[model samples]
Structures are given as C-alpha cells and as structure tokens.
Target: LSTVHIESDNANNTLIAIGGDNVYLTFTPEEPLLLDSIVVTIAGLATTLTESNGSYTATLTLTGSEPDGILEFTIDFKDRAGNPGIQVTATTDESYVNHDIYPPEIEIISITSNNSDSTWAKVGDSVFVTFTASETLDNISITIAGVSSSYNELSVAKYQGYHVMDDSNDEGDIPFLITYTDLGGAIGPDADTTTNNTNVQFDKTVPEFSLTRMATNNVYGDSLAGIGSVDTLSFTISENQRDLNVELAGSQKTPEQEELNFITTHTFSESD
Candidate 1:
C-alpha cells in the first residue's frame, strides 16, 4: 500500500486539520485490490475505503473533543489473490491536527494619552493603548473615538497601538474597541462601544480666568506704594483647578482659600 495524501476540509494539501473538520486520507494500492477488502483506521476510528478514480479514500470527522496531537493512519487490505497486507504511517512534516480548539481571550491593559499630567485628551495628542491576550494573535487593530488604527506586537501575548486625536472626535468620556484574530483564524469580539471600563475624557476647550481688584487705598490709585497699605484681589476661574499658583512682585503665593465656582482671594501688602 502507498499513501497518496492526507488533508482536511479546512486546509487542503496539508496534514494539519482544524478542529471540527473532516479529515480525508487517500491511498493507492501497488496491485489491484478486491472490493470490500480494504479497511482504514485513523486516530483509532475505523473506516472503510471507497474506490474513486483508481484511488481509495477514507474520511474521519472530528468532533473537536479529540486530544490535540499528531494523528496516525492504519491501512489493511487484501490483493486479488487474497494476500493480506498492512501499512501504517503517521502525519508527515511534524504537523498536528485539532491543536487549536479555543479562541484567544483578550483583555485591555490600559488606555492613555500623551498628556501624562492629566487624563484629558486634547486635539493633536497621541492616545496610546495596550492589551494582553491568552494566546498569540495577528491582524490586531484598535478603535478610539471613532478612529481605527492597527496595533504592533510587543511580545507573543502583548500588543500596543496609538491614535492621534483630531477635531472630528467627540468630546466627553471616550471609549475604545479592540479587534484581533487568533492563530487559529478565529475572529475576536466585535467593537465594544458600550463599556466604560477603558474610557478617557476628551476636552478641547481651554480654561479661562479673570483677575479683579476688590479694594482701593489712598496711598496709590490701583496699587499699594508703602508699608501698612493692603489691597485685596479676587481670582475667578472658569473651572475648578488644582495646584493653582499666583505670582506677585516676583514671588509665588498660594490662595488663602477657595470658594464655589473656583473663586479665590489674596491680600497683598507692600513694605519699604
């Protein structure tokens, strides 16, 4: 007996067989064989060969519950004179079948922006994203703020990518989506826009503030000239701010107190 080829319905002309696919084994006999005298077995499953175009073929369907490993085939047949012969062969080229049964599981590690000081993303800023997977993947892509971009593989299980912010993107909390394909050609989950777990705030408007004089003294029209004279100034900001600082006469000073709507006051005194 001579083995012609071994393949599967998913990939033709290859020994590797994907899970849940039918594996076909074809062989040709050295001498003409009698009908109903050929028996074939693969992976311990017995099958009968049918003559087709001068060659005999046997098919075995995998239910995806088979262990992931190499497969072997056994052929037993009898010639026209009833001479029995047996042939055994293994999958060639160190190939395996049914190795990949489960799809890759992916998780988002982090989604950040170039602005390290804040989580707010602005126009022209680069938004970075990183993730991990249970298995190696390919054709990775990430979508952020309606922009889709490809990712780079940093390692077998880690990937990173970035997208530049633009004016077309919407403001407020922004969510991202990730799509990938595992080594088994399994497509990952669709773009998830409803999850807020990896959200980043996007803001384009700049904060504004105003300074006003709250007190006047006779020593100077709008400023303090000498010792014992004091002038109070009020600082009003459009939004709440943290670590606010004020520069007065080449010196830095912190607000005495902060009030509602981001209003702060400071009293300055001049000395000779």
Candidate 2:
C-alpha cells in the first residue's frame, strides 16, 4: 500500500459547523485490491472505499461531533492475494479543515487623543484608538464622526490606530464604532461608543472674557489710587476655564469665587 492522500470538497481552513461536510480520500494499491475490502475512518466515522479509474476513492460525510482542529483519518484494505494492509498515516499537504463553533470576542480597550488635554481636541489634533480580540482578526476598522479608518496590528490580538481631526468634524462630543472579523470567519460584535468611554470634544471657537472692577473698590481702571489700597476685580467669561490665572502687579492670583454663569472674582491689596 502507498501513502494515502486526503482532500476535501471544502476549501482548506474552511470553518465547519455542526452540519455535514464531504471529504474525499485517494490511495494507490501495490497489487489488485479485493472487492468490498477497503475501509476509511476519519474522526471516528468509517466509510467504504471503491476502486475507480485505477485509484481507490471514498467520500465521507463529517456529520459526527469532532474536535475543533485538524481532522485525522486512517485507511484499511486487503489485496487480491489475501494480504491485509493498514495505513494509519496520511498527508494533507497542510490543506487542513478546521472546526470552530465559537465566535470571536472583541473589546475596545481605549479611545483617546494626543492633544495637550486628552478630553478635548482641536482641528489639528490626533485621536488614538485601541482594541483587542480573542484571536487574530482581519478587516478591522474604527469609525469616528462618520469617518472610517483602519487599524494597525501592534501585536497578537492587539491593534492601534489614530485619526486626525479636521474641519469636517463637528464641534462637540464625538462617538466611535468598531468592526472586525476573526480567523474563524466570524464577525465580531460592533463596539459602540458611550459617554463614559469616549471623552474627546472638538472646540474651535476661542473663549472670551470681560474684566471689570468692583464698584465698591477704591481703585478702578485708569483711576488714581492711594498707597496700600485694596481692590476687587471680577471676570465674566463665555465658558468655564481650567487652571485660570490672573497677573496683577507681577503677582499671580487665582479666582476667589467661581459661579455657574462663568464669573470669577479676585481681591488684591496693593502696596507702594
């Protein structure tokens, strides 16, 4: 008996489900083979092989439960001289059939930005996105503000990419969506963005503010004041400012009071 060669009607690495799939095997005999003396078993399922066109061929339907890996098969036959022959090894040339029933599980690790403050982004800012999967994947992409971009593989099961902010983006909080396919030909669940996960905001308008001296203060803008006088200044801003600092007479002062209307006040006592 010669080496048995295995082939499948389904393509190599083709994902097999619970249903039946056909596999064919062929082998050469050293002498004339006996009729009804050929048997082939694959994954614990047995089938008979018949001689056809100078070759022994058999078709087996893989309907039984098999492990989630390469399929192994064995062949047994007898010659016309009553010599029994058994071949337990076969070559598939790496053309393997895989069985996988579970789909890929995907998770978005982070969606961030490279701006000075990760919470906000400007027109020239770059937003970074990262994700992971249960297995290696293909056709991976991330959609942000209606724009789609592909991801680069950083390592096995990890991917990273970035998108630059442009004028086409809206001036508000933006959401993201991700899609990918695993090696088992399963489509992963779409990762939808939420307020708690995504925090980048696009703001283009410059914040405005107006400064006014308190009416009860002894000093006003362009007004003469005596030595050692105390003055209070109020600032009304268009929006809330973080780390706001005010410099008066070469001294830095923080806001004494911050209000919902975006108003901040500072009091200072001057000398000399």
Candidate 3:
C-alpha cells in the first residue's frame, strides 16, 4: 500500500494555528486496499483511526495552554493483509503560530498645519500628519520628499508625525509614503512603493512685503512719516499673497484707496 495524500485543514504547509481545536486529518491511499487501523501522532498526542471510505479520517484534538511551536503529524496504517505500509508524516516548516493573524490597516488622513489647510508649510515649520491604524503596528515609517522618517505612537490606535521642511524642499506637492507592519508581520501590497502618490506641499520662502510710503514728500523726497494724506501710496510685494487686503488698524481699505492706475499689490502664485 502507498499513501496518496495527507493534510489537515488548519495546516497551511508552513504554519498552523490549531488553537486547541479538532483538526480533521484525511489520508488517501494510492489504490484501494483493506485498512485495519491507522495510528496518527500530532505534536505529542496520539490517536487511532478506524473510519475509512476509500480513505481514512481522524479527528485530533489539542488542549492546554501550550506555547506555539513546531507541529508534526505522523500516520501509520495496517492493511487487512496484516502488513504495515510505509509511514507518512507532515510537519510545519518552522513552528506553528497558534495565534490569530490580523493584518495591520494603515491610512494617512491628512497632512496640514494650523496656519494653512492647503497642506502647505514654510521652511522650519512642522507639518503635522495624522494617521490611523487598526492595531498597534510593529513598525511604522513615513517617507516624504524622498526622505524616510520613523513615527512615534501616541495613543492606542492613533499616530502622528512632524516633518520639518527645509531649503531642500522645493515648491511642489511632496509625495508621502507610509509603510507599516502589523504584529503578525503582515504588510500592505504597495508598502515600499516610492512613487509620487500621496503628497503634501512645502514652501521654502516666506512671503516678503515692502511698503514704499509714497506721498507728496516735498523736494527732500522724505514723505510724510506719520498719518499724512496717504494719496497714491506705492506698494511692493515680493511674492503672491492670496486673500490679500490692505488694512489700516482694523478697517480694510477699498480697492480705490489701496490701488492706483500705475501701481498695485504684487501677488504671486506657485503650485507643485
């Protein structure tokens, strides 16, 4: 007699988390032959099987609070001819992990700051990034603008990180890659990908504004220093400023008073 196939539903060939349950073992013979009995050994427990219908089926139940380790299954059968067939055995590759495997779930919610919601941060400004995970991850990292940085766990399932933009960070949508591993060592599909996918923005320079107090300054060209009839005041802005308005103390100035036919506010816009 020759053994055809042997397996346990819980066995994944490498690791099996039986968790002290009844593992149904099935053994098929290469050809139909009279089988008197079958002895099966799982781990250290042994049992005899008598159920057969062209094959043999046995239920092996494990118990106790034993630590997870290597699992080996050995089967020995006797033919009706009172002859013993070849012994068949199957063991896990290394050790059996008898614990539930729950892959980690990670997501990047938002990367923004209190000053701006457009995901824009100036140099030396900390960009706060919010993250959520289903479970406590074993490893968590963030890759922004081609640079990778580790993260610190804050609470149970919430995590955040601060990424400071420097002169190296140009004006563009910075790609953010979050890689994480769960307690079971399971990672996402595109975990290590460095493509420009998820992203934030970085502004290297702060907006610069210059005021040219242009008024009827006599021949000396020293315009009225204080609150003079500020008629036709020339303004110069280094960069573009959005929602910009010229305010005096608390009141916002109208376009007529803030601008003239020759000069206006200098505004610039940049996108990544």
Candidate 4:
C-alpha cells in the first residue's frame, strides 16, 4: 500500500519557546507500518535519524544561536519496506522570544486615606494603597500586617484600591509583602517574596479640652463669670472634635455657702 498521510505533534505551531527551549517531535503515519528512518530539518539543519513504534520521536534542544521567531522545519521519512512516504514541510506561527529573563519591576506609588488624600489618619479612618509594575501581570497580591488579600490579573500594570487598611490597622510601618507572577510566569529571585513598608501615622490619642464661658452676646473668651441675664458654657477642643458631648454640673448655694448639685448632659449640633 502507498503512504497516505503524515502529521506531527508540534503542528498548529502553538507550542513555542526561545532558542534554548526544548522541542519534542512525534511523527504519526497513516498506518502502523514501521519507519525506516526519520530526518527532521530545523532552521535549515538536518538532525540525526532515529525511529520507534511505527512513529518517529526526536527531542531537540535548540541552541542559543537558533533564530528567534518562527521555527521552520521539514520532515522526510520512509517505511520499513523501503518506500518513501511524503515530503512534509511547515513553519510555526509567530512566537515571542524569551528575552525577558529578569524579574518584573514593582513599585509603591502612594498610600492614601480612603476619605481624603492624607497619609496620616485616625485609627478608624479607612485607607488604601496604590502600586504599579513594569510589565503585564498574570497574578498580583498584597499582604499587610497579618492579612493576605486575593489577587487578580491586571489588564494594566498599575493597581490600586482597598488594600487592607482598616480600623483594625495598627500604627507603624505596616509591613506588607507583594507577590506576583508575570504574564510569562517568570519569577525572579525574591520576586514572590518581595515586601514594602508603608509608614502610617495612626492617631489614637484623644483631643485635649478646655472650658470657656460664653455669656449672652459675650465676645471675650473666659472660663469664669458672674451672674448674668443668660449664661452659656462653651467647650474648646484642641482638634476638630466629632460627636462631642458635654456634662454640666448644676449647683445651688445655701446661706451657709453649702452647695447642692445635679448633673445635666448637653450635646453639640453638627454645625458646632
């Protein structure tokens, strides 16, 4: 019978790599006839002949001097009956050269408060971090404090969002580790273990306070006052206070100067 058809495992040209990469070629004939010998020409160079199991298997270790892009090759073989099969020649689809042997570049752009652009925030204030990379990433993640965040593929290298700064965050250089895999899945030395330090000033201290007396239409800020038609007590805080409340002590003086007191509470409005 005449040799009908021939095929290769490396067909469709999807299996690609750099010059130093490995290539495994297995030729399949139309029938299970034993192959006399198989010769493969890659980059215009012929390989040594070898055959097994009615098919041809040749493992080629490409040299660094091989061409970078498309790998052009041809296969010529004959049956054990000494009948020449067919002359097969084909080229691989365009493939990228593995020139990027180094790791991807990672950088911390800024760490800002979620409510504002301030790097310093109160303990309960929400915060976020922004970062970037030099190349497209297959996966990227951040670990802050003792918490690890989920990673996602980045359409662009730069990434930012809620990266785990919350009310539970403590004050200090929040030690964070950034791990990533490049689009080509190349991880350099310490690339997956790279870390960054962000110093976040978390204010947990309460504001200092002072008492002032504001009489009816009184302009002078004073702490003590005498009898007046109307009296108002004012409290001053060192910082912009939120949800402030004041407790007042009501007192009545007897003829013997003995005082009877009662406790009253006052809350401030938002405008105050």
Q: Which tens-of-lDDT digit does each residue in 1-272 have in candidate 2? A: 55467655543234342236576667777677876767777666776566776688766776536666667777777888878876555654544445554556675467778877898888888887777778887667788766886568899998876788899888888677888766645567887664246678887767787665543335464344445444445668777667777765455666566662332333445543
| TM-score of model 1 (CA atoms) | 0.75
**Best model per lDDT:** 1
Best by TM-score: 1
TM-score computed on alpha carbons, candidate 2: 0.74
Worst 10 residues of 2 by lDDT: 260-269
Mark the regions of model 4 whose C-alpha exceeds 4 Å error after superposition.
Answer: 1-22, 30-37, 41-53, 61-102, 107-109, 123-126, 151-154, 189-200, 204-272
Query: Scored by Cα lDDT, where does model 4 land?
Result: 0.50
Clashes of 1: 0
Which pairs in model 2 have colliding backbones?
none
Query: What TM-score would every model get versus the actual structure?
Result: 0.75, 0.74, 0.48, 0.51
lDDT of 3: 0.55
lDDT agreement with native, every candidate: 0.67, 0.66, 0.55, 0.50
Could you tell me which 10 consecutive residues in candidate 3 have the lowest summed lDDT?
A: 263-272
Write one digit per residue (lDDT tens) for candidate 4, span 98-174. Answer: 32334567754455564353646665565455667776654566665446755443348876534445557666554
In angstroms, give how far residue 162 of model 4 lies from its true place. 3.3
Residue pairs with clashing backbones, model 1: none
Query: How many clashes does each candidate structure show, in the order listed?
Result: 0, 0, 2, 0
- Per-residue lDDT of 160-184 in model 1, one digit per residue for the tens? 7778888898988766778877655
Score residue 208 of candidate 2 by CA lDDT.
83
